[model samples]
Target: MSTLNIRKITPTFGAEITGIDLNQPLTPEQEADIVSAIAEYGVCVYPNTGLTDQTHIWFSRMFGNLWTIGGQGTRLSRFDYPHLFEAGNLTPEGGISTDEMARKRRAGDRLWHTDSSFTKERTTYSLLLAHEVPAEGGETGFADMRGAYGALPQAMKDRIEHLEAEHSYLYSRSLAGFPVTEEEVENGMIARHKLVHTHPGSGRKSLYIASHALRITGMAKEEGRALIKELLDFGTQPQFTFNHYWKPGDLVIWDNFCTMHRGGEYDDIHHRRDMRRTTVMAYPPPPVVMDPRFKDRFDPAQFEAMVDA
Candidate 1:
């Protein structure tokens, strides 16, 4: 079994792990060590690691089933391997806004978010490899949600612990000017998640809120809006974030359950940057039932009500 050399960055955010070739299969012992390191550090950065599409997909499978987004293309051809999903520049010229790449550009350029926050079953882990990087800008930034929670005022933390927030792809896409179809909105593909979620394997508490979070349940509309704004602002402070400037051959794996990430702007018009990402579906959280009274409050039926007020 290969041993991992792990170095933690901050009390809450990142770690640099070495001593394993991602190209080869890991023994059960190596897998456990890697998983344990991830639990201890919300993000792990492996430098000088060259990973091919096959190797990347194989590494992703070691965790659990991969997450496939609705409209995004699958990682490899379905005939090859069906579970992984591809992310980043997919255009021929390696440009960001070719007609062929517009949808991905828009989705990725939007604010910080956990992968698939809109889905009922959220993603657990995300593995991304830098294939090409811009000479300037386009750094990926991550915030330690666990650290964000720990830094919150005691009263604020206490107030939101049991509160739940409604997360909807429809809501987030609307903010970014990409509205979802009516069919998707009806399927509960959009879900309500607790404001704070406990990590299943590590027992660490993390702030589960994000930029895409639409509203809080059981709270007045104005109040919920204000609270969401406050929490977002607090949780994304500089002290809680680590910005990664990429170099090719770098594979980063992060715990999506305890961290949030955003894409920083680059000179998309002048330079080219491309990265590939594979996400793992999370082990489901406990069940959450919508209150009958509030069901219509945020649903299509209340669109007019929301507009009227």
Candidate 2:
């Protein structure tokens, strides 16, 4: 493997990595270097990789287990791969979907979030490959959570150091006015995670807040939401974010542990923005630690019923 060409996109976080063939198998050294790059920079963009869907999924597997869409084989109509998320506006007939549910779900992607945070088995890295891009306004914005944590006042950091938050996929989609369906609730879309997470490989601490994070455990809902909002507003300041404008053949990968991302607006009704994502699961799946307070909202029986039904 040749030495990778890495150019910084931002002073602090994102980088463009070159000199690797996505069509071929990655050497162990190359793989390790990519992992280390993600640990250090959070986002790596490989411009014009010309990766096919098969190659994209293959490359993602080199990192870890791929997250199956929706914890089941659930997928959008006309999309072939169950392991890949169809993160686009196009429907089976290649036009923008008219389905209200699909449009509402897509709208929810505008919120800053860490991938799969609502699942007990959260994701580690997400590799998104662009197949089709609109002529304008479909950039994806990413915020540096590690930098956010570093910039927080000492008192603020100390306050949230040991705190935990309840994350709910249902709740987040609801915020976009998408009512939760029974299947989503039964899919175990709620989980609890620490407010501050220390990356094992990088030894860096990052704020773990996301749009999926509904409330802080043991705190009143209104107060917890206020604090969460305050943190999100501060963390997503211009200094901490980079918006990636997509081009066809671009493959961008980012570590979910240290970043929050949201989809930027495009004329979804008139143009197409076809992006597919393969999510690599965090190894040894994070334990499901439930807060009794949220049990009413996230019942174990619902999941059991889902399994039974």
Candidate 3:
């Protein structure tokens, strides 16, 4: 714990953490320090590391329960560790779909998003391990939410402070021409969250924006569209982002609570690109009550049943 080394990559983004092998069990102090570092840095990279499946699960549990992907099954692909959720091309032997579906799946992740933001109780963190990286162009990029919020114009900041937006998994998948099933859309998997979220642990405010956000509350359709476009442009500026080129055995962990990330496109038709991601869920957001006048049209009992399902 005392022997660990932490190096900041940028004033607002990433950190290179050295010392402390992942294969070894962490002490209580070491775990505390690691959590603190993640809060401070947003993203941390442990390079040239090897972790067993059990160790990966144990390390991830230190933060919280591991987040299960919404539509994907409970287990990983046969080629991957059960604890890890695989992303990218289909395996040679067997997989969920053919090579074409895998290609479309990889393509859909190109836009920026916090992992599992569509869920009511979204994932708090994401741990990604590079098992196989394409030789050409499959880097993952992260945007610093704190930096994005800080750089906003005062007028824009004031406008969005009280605003809320609807996040939908269907919208995210639709961007790649792969929409979620009717059951998923009807099951209340979509959620609404504030445009500005205060970190529960640190009390720091961050821009809670992502490519999956479909609309903002109390704003006209055209107005919401324009505002979202403007904010996304400002938030994803290169200065506020860190792009990671992966090598095998590299493990990268980031706080999904205050960061947005996207996958860079690669030759999915040919080159093999595979990464395993695990998400940790957090507490649910406070409820938002609709107007009483609309109660008849928007039934509370129906909504509750949808969420409970």
Models sorted by lDDT, best on top: 2, 3, 1
Count of backbone collisions within predicted model 2: 0
Clashing pairs counted in every model: 0, 0, 1
**Model 2 TM-score?**
0.87
Residue 28 of model 2, lDDT score:
82
lDDT of 2: 0.83
* TM-score versus the correct structure, for each prediction: 0.81, 0.87, 0.83
Task: Find the candidate with the highest TM-score and give its number.
Answer: 2
lDDT of 2 by residue, 1-309 (tens): 435889998898999999888888777888888888888899999999999867787788777767655433444455555457878898766777767878887888999999889967688999999999999999999999999999999999999999999898887887777888646654756799999999765898999989888889999989999999999999999999999999999999999999999999888888988888988877442244544433322233433343354
**Candidate 3 or 1, higher lDDT:** 3
Question: How much is the lDDT of residue 196 in candidate 1?
Answer: 93
The parts of candidate 1 lying over 4 Å away from their true place are 69-81, 92-96, 100-108, 177-188, 284-309
**For residues 6-99, could you state the per-residue lDDT of candidate 3 as single tens digits?**
8888876899888888777788888888888899889999887787555665677677655433235433355433345766575734333344
Ranking by TM-score: 2, 3, 1
Best by lDDT: 2
**Cα lDDT of model 1 by residue, 157-261, tens digit:** 899999998887666665565656645655645678899989775897889877668778989977997998888788888889888889998899998889888
TM-score for predicted model 1 compared with the true structure: 0.81
